[model samples]
Target: MKKVLSIVLALAMCLSLAACAQNPKESTEPSDSVKPTEEAGIYTPGTYTATARGHEDGVQVTVTVDANSITDVTLDVSKETESIGGAAADKLKSQIMDAQSAEIDGVSGATETSNAVKMALQDCLNQAMGVSSDEKTPVADGTYSGTAPSFGLTSQMTCEVTFEGGKMTDIQVTEESDSATGEWFASAQELFIPRVLESQSLAVDAITGATTSSNGIRNCVAAAIDAAGGDSSQWYTEIPKKTDTVKLEGYDVIVVGMGGSGVLSYCAAAEQGATVFGIEAAGKIGGDSVCTYGPMAINSQYLKDLYNNGEDYINADDVYNTWMEYVGSDEKADVIHEAVYNSGSALDYYVDNFGFEFEGMGLLGSFVVPEWTKLWCVYSADDDNTSWNILGPNKTFQFTRALETANAMNEKNEYMTELTATSLIFDDDGKVIGVNAQYYDGTTYEIYGKTVILATGGFLGNDDMMNEYLGSTVSTIGDTVNDGTGIQMGISAGGATYMMGTLPMVHISQVPHLIRTDDLTADQKAILTALALTTDQKMITTEGNVWGNENQSGTEDEGITVEIVYAPDYMYYVVYSQEDIDNIRTNGLTEAQANATSQFLSQGGTLPAAGTPVEDIDQILQVGEEYQNVIKADSIADLAAAIGCDESNLTEALGGVDTTYYAVICDSYAYATVGGLDVDVNMNVLREDGTPIENLFAVGQDSEGVCNADGKAYTPWGGQAQSWTFVSGQIAGTQAAAVAAAAE
Candidate 1:
């Protein structure tokens, strides 16, 4: 009888809908019924209020339903505007009446409100369908235990659950870091309260700093009731036994350099399970990379082909044409370009898999129009080849995808450590096998592995090697370090060399010999220390004098130590008198006082020489010929004549100088050296015969000749050692690993 009634009712409703087309207003809508004032004694459709907390402004909503139809919806509390929740609420309310079930779609812009409405509707619908208030939640009243894993480390946990009428009411989170991580536990408790009471679920996202804590709590709670037979896997999954320690081995592949390229290769080999090691005589890691200030050109034919289709101008339309610009007729540069272009793949792999952050390295002036400064260059964040630079949203030119590929191999694997490689151990066949390391012990240890990588850094510390390899004062140009440790080592063992000729300069700009960094700002350093291309020649200085190497008047002292180069930080000052020294050390005193103070001078510029009177500056200059002050000169005319500067330009430049500023600058300042290393395609050290030695490599500023086909150009400075250290190190590391793995 009820089935028949349902069919009859459905037909009658259809017939009514057809008849209503004749008079649309004749339909009996629920709101059109006789309005009834609220009478306490009378029965009316129950109005349920839904509320959501933790929102920025808080939220409240009410819906009135009559029979199986929604009468009205009102928002009593809200902080959102029409563009957000307001607009969505309007659309949602209109569809609520027609939704026969709780499977209605949510509003577009109002996700939170939509969810709230869905839950509210679910509640109201249950009552309407007569589902009774006897529904029950899952109970957690048993014991559970499990292991939490991360970073190849596993922690254990156990919990006993208690429940109230089939609903979980309490939970406890314990961990090894509990004593020292109380604050993290407090914050975690705050977040966990909602998941248990509101959502009635225990699974949650891991907390940022308190990852271990959050995971511990979740795993314990999740496993508790499951061990009571709720779900077996929830309590204990068949997890594999973890590996905690790695054993040492004999290296099979050996590398002998630690420059940008060398380190990159070595790191690669190490990643491949090679007992990778780098040998650098320098105290620091960055070699020529630290001292360089420019970038290299890497061209990908395929990417260029794709770029040309767009509005951007790329060199890929013609491979030979693009090749001529960077490589010219020299096939070696082409080989270098091919190697570099492909290298991006590996870099991309490294950044995505490892924890590397890339800021997009691409052409700087390629897309810049003379009239428009809005868009300058093309940069990109292309883990999946979609995102771009914050400034230029178009594309990227240089691709580090090469490194990315190698890094991805360990997507489910782990690396043991990131120790700085110090030296490589080689075998008789010239193949690298292992390393001797300055491991945390501060003493050398013979680490036996299958492969050895030489990314120990460059000879930024070997001054003689720089002069001998590049045939110039490459050492005096940029970093005092950049000595050619890699080159010397590689050459001693037979390696090819190329591009090792001129010491690049930042132009012929005359920079200060010594600077006081304590007072100078960054902009001041850029201007004073950078190269000046407009000029041709530069002045040299030695120990505050024109003849720093030796005073002719005092006889040869230090063999003409005229090293007119930039200071480490370009801020070297001298102070005297305890009060003045303490003033600088303790407080600023005052702006005027600070500006007027001497940063690179004592009470007097010079002292009495032998029996000369201290008050007479001229007399002291003549008598103090043996001291560093002998090189000091008051005017550019004296400086030019003393240091072999052109007399005419000296007078002009000196005239342009504000005497006060020039006096301070000439007396104390900083200088920057732009050029140094030169290398062949494979980065091997060349013998005097022009051929590379077997199984030898050099990287960083150890040897000149990486750039400048015609002459000297700026080096890729700063993290130069850092960039190549990882890149070349990785390669060497991987090769070493392969060798080791193969030997094993």
Candidate 2:
């Protein structure tokens, strides 16, 4: 019986083992050697965040996960360029969340931002999964070369980079075709390369006033690093070395800047037998004046002669009252009076001394009076009608002639180009005696004089000043030379500044050359083409507001002023159709419109011919389809989508016009600006206490209490600011010369 029981037990155990082997689910105990697949959804549920180096700074990201799937993703991209890297982050976040994985394709135009997002996501996933962060792949240390496309010129910039111990050591521009490009690169490199080496990352602050060159350098360095297989790490940045200073003395008058006022002041002082010295920040002489049309004079000999010959004449008192009412201030009435009375003489000086000639009187506004038209003293060249035309008809003729005269005068008086005035030197008696300047070679100089003229123009080039004063990011369309250095110096030397928080000389048209055809994408081309087509259209802020022909009435100024003040966000839109285009082509656009059309054609855009019927509107359609700020929609709802406004609101604003196509326009360009250091009737820089700062004078846009006294309106065609440049400069120069002569 015992033997039989043992045999049965052995058979039962064998059967059980076979059954367990056949059906794995039947097994009760778990196997320790087996591994789970990724599909098992093994992850801790929580939110995790990480930061990675990006194009211009750190890109921080947060990721939320539920079990194994990504629930949400957010990014902190304040440091990224809004147009490029910021757009990338927005797109990449959606893609990563949808994919629920870190592995994803990068944004086409924003590769650095894409990589940064990927790395940050990987780190967050590693944290959430309780896994160690993967180390960056090490790169071999060696020298590498790369090149970046040019911006202003027709050539590329080549850069040589050296690496030490898998880290970037040095970066240098080996070849650059354009001299201006080379200088911009050098300026950008001074700030960018050192920061890259210290941070061990491509992210760095772009050099101010040289963003394109700075980005070029960064891209070139990035390419070289990729070629040499380099990775980023945290490192220390080094401080830049300072340049040495030199002292120069023995001048009666020192004029800072070489703009309209600066040149005029120098000439006026030299004529008074004062030893004058001129300092210019740029290589050239003309400042913002080189971009102007002509000057305004209330009672010039030319205008008086026309009036005597039975032409309509404007009363000086009427002009004065109009200006005073416009500026909303009679506090500087004496200064205004002087400008109105002496403006003609100042123009006479330029015409008699520099061979300047007036082509014809130009009507500044839609006003029909011959007197108002006579205010615009258009200059003429000897041979070429286009010689004076830089951006507009007869715009730069006066300035060009002034530049020639200034150069000739420089042969007798001392003048230094590329020497930027840094500060005013004051004596124990609180009088400005000289100026401190810095040359492009990094060497500083102390220039002594009995009198100093602050003609540094407006501060549009300085972003900090603009933000502090203008309350918004205003685009500068003129030359980038007016940096407000003289204004700052005057303030530091006990002078006062005024009317800073005011509207600049804003223009209706888009910034010239902002869109280049060769570099434009299809969407960009379409939007720009639409903009070009609507350039000459009569723009209206609200529906039902009609503007007549260019010379319809004297109400154009009032209309434009009201439009600018009432337009939302200081923006307006142009309304037109195929019919308007045909009309414009038939009647022919004004000189300004023709110039804009010519410019558009030069940028590789096409225009419809006269009497042409509506054909392809693809380019026009593309504007609403692509751009966020612009709109080109057939319905109000679609237009609202493009402009980010309520459909009802937009429809109401458009006066219930829901069928026609519409495009919004805003203040796209800033030509110049007014308001800087406060000045008296004599153009002498004044202190906050209303006392004149002896031996220091401010002129042109550098002097306050001139143009835009009301701080909201501007006289577009009267050459108000240009006229002030001549009148104020004459007064300041004459006063400065007198002071120097008395001292001698």
Candidate 3:
């Protein structure tokens, strides 16, 4: 009797294991279509919970099952992006319950969080079905493709992953958006792909300046892993970091940050015969400077003779006086003089010595005071420069070429990327010496030198610093690696800051969380950009008050007082009625569509002709609604409710809406903070009492404020920031080399 019982029990166990081996389904039908509990019996009556990795941390799901039915479902997606992922939680839960299984349609814009929720919910259902949860589901050997959002809202990064012997052997980016900067994306793909393959894990740190790209790769891989019958949560094993120290001594000058300014500094010091060492936090060399048009030059003789009839583009003396007047005082007259008069010579020095190139001289005139002397020129972006984009020309290769020349000049002149400088090293008597840095792979470095140059860009990437100093946080188009490390190091060495509250460089404006340019066809982008940029109709703030006529979205201004800068959070909504939408789809866009349209949108395609109907306007609006960028309603009160504004305020703003209405979101973007460490004309870091730190220097955005004033926008002349990189870099590099030579 005992033997017979044992055989029966063993057979039952085998059947259970076989059932668990079958692939789990997310959902097959909507909740309303699911059969009643008595007709479709699958689960044991109980509650189960599971968690999976999400955009931030983990998404949790608790599923309550009755015998043959899913009774209730709850989720915690708070760790995801509030506007995108978090907002999709309720819809995801409803779909799971309705299907009475794990399979369901995912929310459109929240792919990452939706996947996590589905994975977690499926695990819960598996648990309630009496399956073992100790080990992960085995991944089948196959190649799979998946996609997730990249930098642009409309664009997604598609990845193809191959699995063999239950291991991810190969991964490749099959499709990506052009809206993402080429340099940053290349850096992300180079470093992140290898790390993921070696560890076979998703818990890797994002590339410092290419975080969105790194996350896009990770999320898309997770989707592929799910498709291959693997438990993605199991592959999220964390990577370990080393905690060891390495030291080096005897360098003449150490430059922190290998951006435009730092590269120039390295070149200047190397030409002066100094053994220079450079440390950059990002995977590439150029920082925000690569994304700029060009520098301001008052009288660059090389440019004058090349572009003009051997005459300076603008008067240097006149510029000096105008700049002084704009700043309101001569508190730092010598530094302003160098910024004005030395600007042309600095441009010449780089062209002659460093292999830098510039072409096309003309106007990048200030928007603040339109008549304030046009002094800027554009960098050369010939056919060989494939990195050029509509936002800015590709000058990153020029920096790379200059660095190559500097490296050739001196064997000891070297720079390391993926290495971040943390603090300044000092001697016993308190003179700045070198820098303490850490490699991305967790190696510590204590590099010693006779002099140090702080050129780590500015604090735009640091949220805490931006909020504390600039009064509020703003969107940035520059590299996110400029987190004020250099400025903090300067303060650690008793250096003072100047004009820390000065306005950031705001230039472009677009729809908030814009659809990636590559995701849409040319015609779609044109129609969308036209609708978002149009201010001809009534525009309203978040509070539902009518916008001022002069508050055009792209027009630059001082402070946040006027223009799109004045909009709360630098965002507003353009209101349109059903008649307008009908006219757009029927008669075509009117002249009103051209009023405030962005020239940058030309990258997409030309705006449709006035009074020519756009055949796809309705489809375009549907896509906009899916991304939560467009809100539509049948009544004014309903529209107000969708926008989270008082009905009365909206009614007043729109003059009592009588038809269906739509609101399109618009936002302004900035480059970086212009304020930084105080420095003299020689680019020497200054103490609070107005004395220079003997062996220390500052350059680029790290000390560009000497040319501007607090409580105002950066010297509105376009490319002024890039010009400072050239001017201050030459001064600091040569001055630091002199100091090192004197010490030796």
Specify the highest-lDDT model's number. Answer: 3
Give the per-residue lDDT digits (tens) of candidate 1, residues 708-728: 233223221112222333333
**Number of the top candidate by TM-score?**
3
What is the overall TM-score of model 2 with all chains considered together? 0.60
Structure candidate 2, residue pairs in collision: 327-710
Error of 2 at 212 (Å): 7.8
Task: Report lDDT (CA) for all predictions.
Answer: 0.35, 0.60, 0.75
Summarize candidate 3's per-residue lDDT along 199-266 as a digit string, tens digits: 88877777777767887888778768767766564565656788999998899999999898999998
Off by over 4 Å in 3: 1-144, 152-155, 179-181, 226-233, 363-374, 382-387, 425-433, 517-522, 550-562, 582-586, 594-607, 613-622, 632-652, 656-661
Backbone clashes under 3 angstroms, per model: 128, 1, 8
* Model 2: residue 415 alpha-carbon error in angstroms: 2.4
**lDDT-sorted candidate list, best first:** 3, 2, 1
Total colliding residue pairs, candidate 3:
8
Q: Residue 633, candidate 3: how far off, in angstroms?
A: 6.1
Candidate 1 Cα deviation (angstroms), residue 511: 4.3
lDDT for predicted candidate 1 compared with the true structure? 0.35
